[model samples]
Target: MRIYKVGGAVRDRLLGIPVTDIDWVVVGATTEEMLAKGFRPVGADFPVFLHPKSGEEYALARTERKSGRGYGGFTFHASPEVTLEEDLIRRDLTINAMAEDDQQNLIDPYHGQRDLEARLLRHVSPAFAEDPLRVLRVARFAARYAALGFTVAPETLELMRQLSESGELEALTPERSWKEISRALMEDQPQVFIEVLRACGALKVLMPEVDALFGVPQPPAHHPEIDTGAHTLSVLEQAALHKQPLTVRWACLLHDLGKGLTPEEEWPRHIAHEFKGLKLIKAVNERFKAPRDCQELAMLVGEYHTHGHRALELKPSTLLELLQSFDVYRRPQRFEEFIAACEMDARGREGLEERSYPQADYLRGASTAARTVAVQPLLEKGFKGPELGEAIKRERLKALKAYKEQV
Candidate 1:
């Protein structure tokens, strides 16, 4: 059997990127033969094994047939007769379809190298439309290579649009959808992911809450971009620029959903959009089965991001209440993440990206000062039960009042 290094490792190597993992495709190999050679079976859907020494994944060269609808409705055929070319043609993107032999000979039956040089993300074949997941995958690749000047081929984008309109995207499981989305959010240009999805209409299907924001108007004075959707994308871009974590990035993306739900008469104003956005954020979190930390942070940001923007204007009691709401003393990291998300929101407006966000430092300092209020001191004064809680609140408020005065 001849083994060829395939997929991302080969693609990234051609792009002069540091390859993180290597996947191999074995031509002219049977499952029995792979097992006899000491490879451990690990694939759940098809014939895949792990090298006994390196533990890298080795999948048999295979061809797939679309048996029905959605991504899972496929039958894979793997045998000694399956050619390397046949396996390569089944990949989603041409750049990912190339392979390399042990002698380092490049195999480009699909001209993946040519597409790579052109900085284009093109489909391997017309068969690309058979899997709905490819739409998300292509968008993710767009996000990854956006810095490298890559653009999705027009034909491939048309195919993606067709797939989006085919009702197939609705068939994707929450786990699978989130897998692609979470990965895209970590990419360097995650805003492009949303743009691509919106272009293909998948955002309307998978995340209508976000889709609804596109045409929604906002006060031009606060948001020079004017379009709420444009503002959201700007926020995501800011989060990326700041190198914020996934939780913060996600919060920035969904922070303005309530703007879309405002009455037309409200026009440029969304007075209580923060309160209105909580349900939409929760729905998105539940639909994606997002991690608890991500969901929790998103919810907090949705409900109180305005409070963060107005940190200096809030009364000392209100500031203390906001700190207590976030449980800043016990969960300081999450509080930090919330501040980062709020900073992204404040900076997302057109022409405001480089503007200072003193609210973040102010709130952080407030949390720190409030956290220093000693419960032991209050208890030593013979405060007990309800009295102890009241005394601690009084001291924390007093400290915040003094802190506010200093600011």
Candidate 2:
């Protein structure tokens, strides 16, 4: 049997980037023969083995046939007779289809190296349309390599558009869809992911709430970008630029959903949009089965991002209430993330990308001051039960009032 290193490891290696994962394809190997060696069986549907020493995955060279619908509708055939070229042709992108031998000889039956040099993401074959997941995968690759000036080939994008219109993306489970989306959000250019999805019509199919924002108008004075959709993407861009975590990035993406619901008669004004956006955020969270941290932070950012922007002007009582709403004393990290998302929104407008966001520091300082209020002092005064809780709140508010005065 001959084994060749395949997929992302080979691609990243060619690009002079650090290779984090390594997969193998073994030609002229049978399941019984693999078992006779030290490899351990791991695959549920096909013949895949884990190396006893390195624990890396190794699968027999195989070919696939589309048997049903969605990403999981494939039937596989793996045997000693399957060729490496056959296995390579079935991959989604040409750059990912190349392999390397033990001697470090590059195998490029599908011109993956040529496409890589061209800075293009091209499909390996017309068979690329069989799996709907490739649409997301290609967009994710676009997001990942956009810094390197790589773009999807026009013909490949046409296929993606066709797949989007075929009703196949609807069959994707929320778990699978979210897996791509969350990964894409954490990429260096997260907004490119959204742009690619919108270009291919997948955003309209999977996330109509976000897609509807494209043509929606916003006050040009506050949002020089004018288009609400453009503003949302700008927020995502700022979140990525700051190296924010996934929860913060997710919050940035959903913070302006209510703006899409504004009446055209009202034109650029969207009064009370913060209150109108909470239900939309909850719906998106439930639809994608986002983690509780992501769900809660997104809702908080949606319902009160305006408060964050107005931190300097709010009354001391309102400031204390906002801090209490975020539970700053208990979940300080989440409060910090909320502040970051709000700052991203404030800075996301056109020509405002470099503007200062003093509100973040103000809110953070307020949280620190309130958290420093001693509960032990209340206990010493004989406060207890519900009365103690109320007393502690009063002292925290008093501390915030003093902080407001000094700052």
Candidate 3:
């Protein structure tokens, strides 16, 4: 059996990037042979194994045929007869189809290296259209390599558009879809992921709430970027620039969904859109089966981002209420993520990228002051049960009030 380093390890190495993981393809090897050699079988749907020593994944060279529908509807064939070239041809992108042999020889059967130099994301073969999940994978690759000036090949984009129109994107499981989406959000140019999906019309199918924001008007006075969808992308861009975590980035993406639900006659003004967005966020969370932390932060940002923006104007009691609503004492990190999401919204407007968002610091200070209100003192004074809870709230409110006066 001949083993070759394949997929992302070879792709990243060719791109002058740090290779994070190594995947091996064992050609002319059967599952029985692999097991005999002490390679632990791990792939339930296909023949994949962990190496006996290094513990790296070593998948037997396999070929697949479209059997039914969606991404998982595939029949895989792995045997001593399957060629390494056949296995490479089934990859999603050209750049990822290349492989490196033990002798350091580059395999370029599909011209992957050429496309890599061209900074293009091209499909390995026409078979790419068979898997709807490739749409998200392509967009995610676009997001990851956007800073490197990569663009999807025009023919590849047409295929993606065709896939989006095929009604197959809806068949993907929520868990699988969210896996791609959440990883894309953590990429360097996550907004590009959304842009690519929208370009191919997959966003409308995958995330209609986000798609509805397109062409919706917003007040030009506050959002020089006018279009709600454009504003959302801008906010996501700012989140990337600030290196905000996935929770903050996700919150920024959904924070404006309610603006799309506003009446046309109301035009650029959206009254109580914050409350309206809560439902949209819930729908998104439910559909995607998003992580609890991500869903919680998105919901908080949706319902109270405006309050965060108006922190300086809120009464001390109101500020205390907001802090308590976020449960800052128990989950302070999520509150900080909420503030980051709000800051991204504030700075996402055209020409306002560098503008100050003192609201973030204000809320952070308020949280700090509220947290310092010493529940121990109340307990020591013989306050018990619900009475202790009431005393703690009273002291926190009073401390916040005093801090507000000092400010």
- How many clashes (backbone N, Cα, C below 3 Å) per candidate? 0, 0, 0
Q: Write down the TM-score for model 3.
A: 0.98
State the lDDT of candidate 2 residue by residue for 267-329, as single tens digits.
Answer: 789998888888888989999999999999999999999999999998888998998899988
Q: Evaluate residue 109 in candidate 1 and report its C-alpha lDDT on the 0 to 100 scale.
A: 94
Clashing residue pairs found in predicted model 2: none
Estimate, for each residue in 45-113, the C-alpha lDDT of model 1 and write its tens digit: 999999999999999999999998887999999999999999999999999999999999999999999
Span of ten consecutive residues with least summed lDDT in model 3? 372-381
Ranking by lDDT: 2, 1, 3
Q: Clash pairs of candidate 3? A: none
Candidate 3, residues 57-175, lDDT tens digits: the string is: 99989999999889899999998999999999999998999889998799989999999999999999999999999999999999999999999999999999999999989889999
The local distance difference test score of model 3 is 0.93
Off by over 4 Å in 3: none
Which residue segments of model 2 deviate by more than 4 Å? none
